[model samples]
Target: MSRLPPAIFLMGPTAAGKTDLAIELAQALPCELISVDSALVYRGMDIGTAKPPSALLEAFPHRLIDIRDPAQSYSAAEFVSDAREAMAEISASGRIPLLVGGTMLYYRALLDGLAEMPPADAQIRAALEAQAEAEGLAALHRQLAEVDPESAARIHPNDPQRLVRALEVYRVSGMSMSEHRARQRAQKAGAGESERSILPYTVAQLSIAPAQRQVLHHRIEQRFVQMVEQGFVEEVETLRERRDLNPEMPSMRAVGYRQVWSYLDGDYARDEMLQRGVAATRQLAKRQLTWLRGWDGIHWLETSARDNLPRALKYLESLSILS
Candidate 1:
């Protein structure tokens, strides 16, 4: 275990002061920061994503930020591949790689290797779309229930993208997504140590959040309002001018952006947009907390505590990760 290179994971829900804590640790330790966020990869989405200010980013220089345009898609597989390369570079340079973000899926894929599943087939997707058009989304969902009940139960009927992809996976391969994941787990169990370990690092995982759920809810609401005051609407307006972008795109589907875009489209009044945006952000935080609650071997810190840096340092020392 000591032969593996040292790394750190700083994970937390949004508005939990994770960025500030990460910066503090980076300053104190020989560490290079790598972003694990799904939205931070986009080039033009700054205010809504609450990306670090230009000066701060320049000083810290996190890897994998602003590496893709909004028109492009970034997958968990891509994140794992890119992150491994970044980790290798940081370790080779004699510094620990400090990955920080609220994107739990990326972190999960990086920790447990992704299942090797069949790729998307355009022909199958087109057929699924046509079938949905003919026999409403509910009917398609029912079909998915018959074929892959586990995925059907997990994915909401309103989430057409995931609904379609789940069915697509079933059609492309004769196996359900759950089956593929189980197969991957079984194979890993039978494999050698070098083959089973996906992330080759002595990792120290830390999660920070407000002790009270209401405090986090309040923070999410206040932060959404603050983002709007910081010209989040204008930022979306600039992206709207791009012909290739739309509300259905993954970038625009980000919590705050979706609400602001609807407001601009006259779907609702500005007040309603603000309310919906804050609500959506709170929901996002709840989901993040749910994920963190089930995670294993993570050190928890309170967002309201002033001595988080010292506490985190002590925890790392206990783990023998910092000498």
Candidate 2:
């Protein structure tokens, strides 16, 4: 067995009870919580991101949440770096790092590492933004499909940040983003396991979801409605008061936030915003599940199961990672 420190990844789609499970596990084990969510990183995005309440956060003390302003941008590479540091600190304190959230891309980057790509060129990004403004996002997506079909297929057409970045990588590096990732994969394939793995921790991957797809869909719809009742529109209204923020920024484009921002902008009515928000959340869950389904070595648990905490502990015991 490897002599690395132990870490736990509690992954699932939105409204899958992952936060509750992680909190239970933390209470049982000597673990520090590190959020693996992209949306939760932004400050003042509480209701929409489903961020833990301030009281709960003060008690549990999760790292990497609300670390950025809504006007700024955060990347997967930054997340990987911050997460590694947090994990190292937790391990040094003689505790395991329990990462919990539904952000599949962040989990993948932390696990497998990211490829080296060209740095962002402001001129290129500005040009792409202008092109998007003139020709539309669909046009940019079509252009990406021509050059990087794999990336185009993976990134949603509505994801302007990723879509723009993919095109920028092609423009700056003279190679598709997919090619850069493929090259990195090829290099890792020839390396030893220790060298290939970016994380030094012996990780236990756990995923929780409702047993039935329809159940999850229902839960998602209910959660979105709850968020609205919890002043989701007012939250967006406060954000709209900022001079620097806009609908196109990564933070604003989050599943529910975008719909609410559009509604506030008079682009749609409140009812339409509610419908779009719920649909967008369901789509996000679908994408997250698609990523997890292709993942290996995951210990699956049903959200409805009462014995999940014990089952997760049993898995850790089997791996001999629990001290």
Candidate 3:
């Protein structure tokens, strides 16, 4: 059945109740959600990353969750390819593909192909991580700016994760991240000229802006505490038992992991650890919101009330998306 792959993408910031709302929509519509989250892909990572409970899965079908071990590497490019295949499979199964996640890059990768970024070099990454630990992330950002001014111009100094990656890329490839990016852009443009290879999904993005920053901050703090009570500490301890996994790995670098890691390393005091974890999560949410706002071709829904899903559904329907 060669049909237009009918699908929808629902995206929003963290702690926005997207999970339940997505399942609710499934009841009224014929759809199965594919996770677009980078964090939710890891197996045995439930509390901190907040993978949907088993009951939710029984209620509505989901793809791309628990697809990778915590120690393994998963990239946006791989996600794009796998998710494209998943979409085809879902369509073949006579199901609608409704994708959900807060990971902006994954969403973009699915909507428009990601440029081929070079693979990570372990030794180079270790060197960069060591430098960040010994000196500071600011110095690393400066180093990246010195080497890849173009990428540095776009990446904020506070974005230590991306800055370190850019530095590592330059270290391994002998090409500035800027040059690599330019080359990728050229290739992407060439691909665009031939035909649109972007995933053919009926993307519908929905979101609710927190009216008060303090409320969002409060939510972040509460969620961190809940995750802690929900065995996040134990989860990190299990990951710690992995002799190969480093704190620099993308999975390990998630908000709570780093803080609990510092605590386990006997570095941070109890109060400092909690504060840092909560603060990092807030910052992450802020960055996610920035990315969501900056994205083009995204349909946003700003709801003032708690039951925002209905309004979001109505918005999608208004956009000529059928139920």
Please provide TM-scores, in order, for all candidate models, with all chains considered together. Answer: 0.92, 0.94, 0.85
Alpha-carbon deviation at 78 in model 1, angstroms: 1.2
**Over all chains combined, what TM-score does candidate 3 have?**
0.85
Q: Can you write out model 2's per-residue Cα lDDT over 223-286, one digit (the tens) per residue?
A: 9999999999999999999999999788998899999998988999988998999999999998
C-alpha lDDT values of all predictions: 0.90, 0.92, 0.77
Question: Which of 2 and 3 is the better model by lDDT?
Answer: 2
In model 3, the clashing pairs are none
After best superposition, candidate 3 residue 318: deviation in angstroms?
3.4
Candidate 3 lDDT score relative to the true structure: 0.77
lDDT of 3 by residue, 1-323 (tens): 44355677777777766776777778867777899888888887788887888887777768999899888889888898888888888878887788887887787667656665678888888888888889988898888778888778657676677887888778777898768757776777877742134666555666555667777788779988888888888888888998988787788877688889888899988788889899888877887788777776665654247666677677778765674
lDDT of 1: 0.90
Error of 2 at 208 (Å): 0.9
Ranking by lDDT: 2, 1, 3
Task: Evaluate model 1: give its TM-score.
Answer: 0.92
